[model samples]
Target chain A: MSPSDFLIIPFDDWVNFLVRDWLVPNFRPIFRAMQVPISMVLKGLDDFFAFVPMVVTTLVFALLAFKYAGRGMVIFTILGFAFIDMIGLWPETMTTLSMILTSVLFCTIIGVPVGILAARSDLTWKIARPVLDIMQTIPSFVYLVPIVMLFGVGMAPGIIATIIFALSPIIRLTNLGIRNVRTDLIEASTAFGSTPMQMLFELQLPLAMRTILAGLNQTLMLALSMVVITALIGAGGLGLTVNTGLGRLDVGGATAGGVGIIILAIVLDRITQGLGEQKKVETTSLRQTLISLFKPGAPAPAHAGKAA
Target chain B: MTSKISVKNVFKIFGDKPGHALDMLKSGQSKNDIFEATGQTIGVQNAAFDVKEGQIFVVMGLSGSGKSTLVRMLNGLIRPTSGEILIDGDDIASCSPAKLREIRRQKIAMVFQHFALFPHRTIAENAAYGLKVKGVSSDERRERALLALEQVGLSSWADSLPADLSGGMQQRVGLARALATDPHVLLMDEPFGALDPLIRKEMQEELLVLQRTLKKTIVFITHDLNEALMLGDRIAIMKDGEIVQVGSAQDIVSQPANDYVAAFVADIDRGRVFTAATVAIEPSTLQLADDTAGDAVRTMEEENRSAVYVLDGEDIAGVVTYQQAAAADRDSGTSDVPIADVLITDFPTADRDTQLADLYAPASSGLPIAMTDADNRLIGVIEPEAVFAQLSADPATPDTEPQVEADQRELAPTA
Candidate 1:
């Protein structure tokens, strides 16, 4: 016997028994309820991506990149989509996009409010900090077993696991951003008789937008990285393609799927980053940007269009 | 004048279980002793004062003296552990949160030390924030905000972000924000403390000018004694979480309540703090209608002075110097020449309330300065010697004894 045998606890067996005998039987309905929303969002986004024609999708994304991220991003988006289509990985890439989008949507809906609560109350932060640390630190594969056991091997469960893995940063950063607002500004708001709700929505949220966007960027990247690990549970996407290619030892196919994910990640990252990194002084509203885009003599859009 | 804000025996203890700390405080345990026992810091202790309507009541102290804490309690920003804060006779200290918020919105507004203009907002938006929190309509908010900005001379910068403005302009925006609400009371916590001395002086003057028309009851907090003297109608001086003295500038300078207040006022420029009336003496007069040039000279010699004011009834006819009276008597070859003919009428007269700082130019003429009442009758004379003596007296040393004796003598006749 090894030193490990000195205190044998049977922790793995306890977890296994807990999942198989108690949790799966008891919490199955609750888990199914959880999956319903994720599945509905994932299916809607997935079907929408599948329904749009390839050229129209490419042109629309290219136009968005041009409008938001400038000429360099527009050129890259168009060429990158064309390369993915040529390699016949467009459908798989679309499925992966939908998965990432769905994970982000649910993460935002849950994470932001939790973050705000944590920011407002010390007790909430005390409770949330440890859970967030665990979610961030645990290996993605360890939770896969329980997720598969509960929701059983599908796209929705994979996306659910992706959300769990990616949720921490958004919550942590949102809390930090609101907490970091200058004390003088907070006092000024309070001195002016702002209700707690008005303070949160009008002052705190607007001031913390850049930091929250950065958190969203981080969450999206984390969700994207979870794609292949999620594919182990039979989720369909470029991740499935990559896993299948790896199982067959087809290096060329695996490289093609890996390249497609990289291209899609780069496009998403650039667009979101551009949204956050606008000039702080002289911040133009979205309406202003839209108006300028359509204005006859607007210099930025004209220059961007010419460059494209 | 009605009391707009009345704070009675307010105390603020910062920590968990403030109730226990408050109990210790009420039982006469020292702040440090309670801190050692319970780890609770007393921020303000037994603070009480009444701020009259349209009065600038300045609370002045160095850092960590709890002046800031006392000011914050007035608006319910920091609730007091025990006591009453009555704003217009409504006890804000015991009011519910909703009622307190309503009070803050409609009745009171504050300007912060660092000018706390929202970084992301336009100047007009920052100015309109108080009105916005009060749920004013957008058009009226903008209109009033622009008007306030115009009052502070920054209406043209209304569309620009706070980052685009200088520190002085940002503070003006802070002032404009407070003004936009048209509050009954304004709480300013070192609003100009962050500015350089030049801008601070300009802002102080601007605030005084603004107050002439606005006449809002203002509680101004500052660490600088000179600023307190300049801007405060009445001042409360705080030290170690207690108010040591509260009085007008002249009262504090002339008779500080304790050593702490004395030391604080020691470095202040007394000329600006004291009025001409404070140094004035009862004038020796030769009646213009009855006395001659010889009598004027005789009176000056008797009084051991260079001049005697010649009064026509109660009003000053003019002043006659010994040289002018003697010359007039010699030229006319008669000791009975009229005092009016020898009277020199070009001398400057100061109002009784004129600051001694402004009396320097007239005092330089080597003649006694007349302190006149509002009806242009000479109530007293501020001799050049008295002006120099008062200005040069060092209050920080034992030598101030002679000055105190002189002050007593000056007050004797008036009393």
Candidate 2:
């Protein structure tokens, strides 16, 4: 036994064997089952983006940005999309946008309820808190390995990795936001005879909307960053553009992809943040006011409808 | 009638092992002793009282004295570690969730010290919240909310956000919120405690005036004894989670149950609290304006007094001194002359609720202060000495028999 061999343990081999045989084989069926919903959402988003011309999509986003973030964002979004198209990354940009949106859509659908559960029950919070910590603390790249082994190398696997990477922030913040809703308000609501569901919808969620939106923003940003990284394992999009540009040493193309990603990141971040800001204003939107008239029992759906 | 709200042997021990803490408390451990031994806080201890219908029943104590806790229990906001809270004959402590919600909606409503108005909502919306929870139609609830806001003089500001209002206005919104529910009972946990002195006084007056017409059972919590004295029809004083005493304002003020209660009541301004009504006594003798001056003098002599009130039936005409009656009699040269001409109307008159502080000028003018009813009928009279005696802090003094003994005796049986 040489010096190097003398200190060695079979930890790596054990982990490798666990993943290759037991873990992968046992969880393959579960992963395969997960593919159904994932593909459905992915395909829906892909086709939706494909049907809308790049110009139309840019204008729609610009209109949304104008509603939420104001004039500066509108201009930025319009110019940014036109630049991405001029650089011939329009198709790839759409794929990336679809992937990021799908990832966030799934994250929001899953994260919020789980966050609500965590906020409600201390036992659920106790179990969830550490799992979220582990998911967040593990390097983003580490998620790709199990994702690749289980789902194989492709856009779906990349998306699964992005979903996992982006999942923690929304859950953690939703839990925090709900928990942070003033105890006095909750007590007042309860004292006034709000049912638990009523309390959550009427008192807790409305009060917690801003914080939860902040969480969505964080989750969206994480998904975008992860999507770029996920391009490594044959996932197509802007990440592929950058990775290919890097391989061919074409700085200009890579820089263009980087600029597109940056613009998307800033635009999304600003829009989500602005949605939270709009909630702070005393005025309710005309649509919300109408919704309120129609759905009297529902909580104010201004933020919830948008996030969902 | 059944009590509007009744708390029976209620104890709230705050900790994981309240049941165990309660057992220890029942087995003779003091609150502090229990806390030291078991790390459990006794939020309320063996508290029992009945708030009558249409009464403002105040629970008063310093901070951390469980006054808030005791009031919270009325609406089942804080469940007692053991014992029962009955609201209009339904024991809320044992109520199921659905039943509790029904009781909270239809029977008892609460107002918080911090206002607890939702910042995102308009004041009208906050006021209508209870009604909304009760499944009232939007139009009806909004109407009721506006009506309640009108009661609190806040209807005009209903559309404004709660944060835009002053502290006092916000509390009015809280009060209006509670009022809109039209519940049988209102639980106010230091609802006006956060207001400034001037605003607090105004709110107290407003609440009293509102109570006159609304007639809802109110359980108010406050640390300010002056507020308790001013607002409470009956007040219960709590200390260290235990109710030390419970009685009317006069009873608690004049005959404190113990030194702790005495100390609490000591700083209270008695002149403002003890009204002309509380201090007034029956006149020793009376004379009619139509009576002969001879008869008036004779009655005055018999009563060993200088003056007599000239009564025109239940109505008070004036006060006449012996000299005035005799002089009128001599001048007219007849005992048959009516005493009405000799009657003097120079003394001060006040309504029954007039503060003793206001009565001082007239009371010290060497004439007894004449107290009148709404119809200007003489109810009773308050002398400078009587006012002094009633205002005195020493309860053991013999001269203040009517002031001290009457209230104590009335309360003794119930206490």
What docking class should model 1 receive? acceptable
Q: Give a tens-digit lDDT track for model 1, residues B2-120.
A: 78999889999999889998889899999899999999999999988888899999999999999999999999889888899999998988999999999999999999999988888
- Provide the interface RMSD of candidate 1 in angstroms, 1 decimal place: 8.7
Interface RMSD to the true structure, each candidate: 8.7, 8.9
CA lDDT, every prediction?
0.88, 0.85
DockQ score of the complex predicted as candidate 1: 0.41
Q: What is candidate 2's DockQ?
A: 0.39
Model 1 agreement with the true structure over A24-114: per-residue lDDT tens digits: 9999999999999899999999999999999999999898787668889999999999999999999999999999999998889999999
Which runs in model 2 stand beyond 4 Å of their true positions?
Answer: A1-9, A13-17, A281-308, B284-290, B326-337, B345-347, B374-376, B393-415
Counting clashing residue pairs in each candidate, in order, gives 0, 0
Q: What is the TM-score of each candidate against the true structure?
A: 0.91, 0.90
**DockQ each:** 0.41, 0.39
What is chain B's TM-score across the candidates, in the order shown? 0.91, 0.90
CAPRI quality of model 2: acceptable
